[model samples]
Target: MTAKWREREKTGIRMGRRRRMDMILFNMVREELRGRVRRLKPDWNQLFDRANANKSDRWRCW
Candidate 1:
C-alpha cells in the first residue's frame, strides 16, 4: 500500500523476470554447446587415434 512497499514489489518482479531470462539464455547456450560437441565427437575421436598412431610411429623410429 505504501510507496516503499510498491517499489519493492516492482523490483522483485523485475528480478524474477531477469532470472527467468537468464535461465532461458543459459539453456539455449548449453544446448548449442552440446550439439556442437555431438557434431565434433567423431572428429575428436579420429584426431585422438591419429595422435596415438603417430606417437607409436615415432617410438618405432627411435
Candidate 2:
C-alpha cells in the first residue's frame, strides 16, 4: 500500500477508537445525572409541598 493509504487507515482506526470512548463517557455522565435526579426528586417535591402549604396557611389567616 502507498504511504498515504497507510496514513489514512491509521487515522480511521484512531477516529473509531475516539468515537467509542466518547460514547462510553457520554453514557457514564448520563447515568450519573439520572441517579442524581432520582435522589433529588423527592426532596424537590417535599420543598414544593411545604411552599404550597405555607401559602395556603397565609391565605387562611388573612
Candidate 3:
C-alpha cells in the first residue's frame, strides 16, 4: 500500500482527477495556512486539527 501510494503521488493521479483533485489540494493548503496563522502552534497533530475543523465548517455555497 505504501508503494502504491508513492506511485500515485509520483504519477500525479490525484491531480489528474476532476473537481475533487483541486478541492483536496485547496483544502490542504487552506488548512496549512490556518495552522500557520495561529501562535503556539500544535505539536504533531496539526493535520488532525485541520481535518476536524474542515468537517464542521461545510458551507452551503460549497
Taking all chains together, each candidate's TM-score versus the true structure is: 0.38, 0.38, 0.33
Query: Which residue runs does candidate 2 get wrong by more than 4 Å?
Result: 1-15, 38-62
Each prediction's whole-model lDDT (CA): 0.52, 0.52, 0.54
What ordering of candidates by lDDT runs from best to worst? Answer: 3, 2, 1
Inter-residue clash pairs, candidate 3: none
Q: Candidate 3 — what's its lDDT? A: 0.54
What's every prediction's RMSD, in angstroms?
A: 21.2, 22.1, 9.1
lDDT agreement of model 2 with the native: 0.52
lDDT of 1 by residue, 1-62 (tens): 57775676567557685465456546755666676775754344554454356363222211
Task: Provide the lowest-lDDT 10-residue window in model 2.
Answer: 53-62
Task: Give one digit per residue, the lDDT tens place, for model 3 in 1-62.
Answer: 37765565555645554355458757876777687776555343666565456563222113
**TM-score-best of 1 and 3:** 1
Q: Please give the lDDT score at residue 6 for candidate 2.
A: 61
Query: How far does residue 32 in candidate 3 sit from its true spot (Å)?
Result: 0.1
Best by lDDT: 3
